[model samples]
Target: MRYVISFIWAFMLTQMVNFVLNSLGGGSPYMFWSGVALAVIITATIAIFDVMLKHPDEENEAQHNH
Candidate 1:
């Protein structure tokens, strides 16, 4: 579910950038591949951050520290 959302968000972001580029007469010939690459990178980055930041024992650790 999160993956799907992340892909959609990344793809739409790429589309918006492409739209801007096209309007500026600087569009890429590899829009589809570029979008895919951006989506993969964004999704992997989100996943990595989620794993690194979301610990189930965070509250316990905080309590122990206090």
Candidate 2:
């Protein structure tokens, strides 16, 4: 559920940036690549933060179980 929300948030953010760039006369290829890059960056940042906020005990337990 968190990941799903993150993805949707990233998509919306990318679209907003793409819209602004397009209005400024950016090319289609530039718009597409920029949007993709933004989405990747946003998703990765959210995932990293989520992991950082997770409990250390839970992480250790999961690792030990595996």
Colliding residue pairs in candidate 2: none
The lowest-lDDT stretch of 10 consecutive residues in candidate 1 is 26-35
> Cα deviation of 11 in candidate 1 (Å)?
1.1
- The digit string of per-residue lDDT tens for model 2 on 1-66 reads 888788788988898879877878855454566777788788989999988899999999999999
Per-residue lDDT, model 1, residue 66, is: 97
Model 2 spans > 4 angstroms off: 25-30, 57-66
TM-scores of the models, in the order given? 0.66, 0.60
lDDT of 1 at 61: 94
- Please state the error at residue 48 of candidate 1 in Å: 0.5
Q: What 10-residue stretch in candidate 2 is worst by lDDT?
A: 26-35
Candidate 1: how many backbone clashes? 0
Q: After superposition, how far is residue 15 of candidate 1 from its true place, in Å?
A: 1.9
Query: Which candidate has the highest TM-score of all?
Result: 1
lDDT of each: 0.79, 0.82
Q: Measured by TM-score, how close is model 2 to the native structure? A: 0.60
